[model samples]
Target: MPLVHIDLIEGRNDSQIKGLVEDVTNAIVKNTGAPAEHVHIVLNEMKKDRYSVSGKLKSEEDQ
Candidate 1:
């Protein structure tokens, strides 16, 4: 089994998230020989105010 965890600031639509997971699953399957059904993905979407980099919150960065 292959497990993948992805974290991002919340903004993308459902289709975008679906595409991201599909792409990630394909990559894992291709590289590790894992079955697509056996690949597990966890997506953690954080609010812009809850995520930060270099002392700047994502929401602040956007302003």
Candidate 2:
């Protein structure tokens, strides 16, 4: 089994997120010889205000 964890600022639509998981699963299966059914993915969507870089919050950057 292969486990993947992805974290991103919230905003993307459901289809986009689904596509991401599909692509990631394919990549893991190709590289690790894991079955697609055995691949596990966890997505964590954080609010922009909760995620920051270089002392600037992502929500603040949009302003």
The residue-by-residue lDDT of candidate 1 on 1-63, one tens digit each, is 888999988999999999999999999999999999999999999999998889988899778
lDDT of 2 by residue, 1-63 (tens): 788999999999999998999999999999999999999999999999999999999999889
What's the count of clashing pairs in each model shown?
0, 0
* TM-score of predicted structure 2: 0.96
Model 2: lDDT equals 0.95
Residue 39 C-alpha lDDT in model 1 = 99
TM-score of each: 0.94, 0.96
Note the Cα lDDT for every prediction shown.
0.93, 0.95
Backbone clashes in model 1, listed as residue pairs: none
RMSD of each: 0.8, 0.6
Q: Which candidate is the best by TM-score?
A: 2
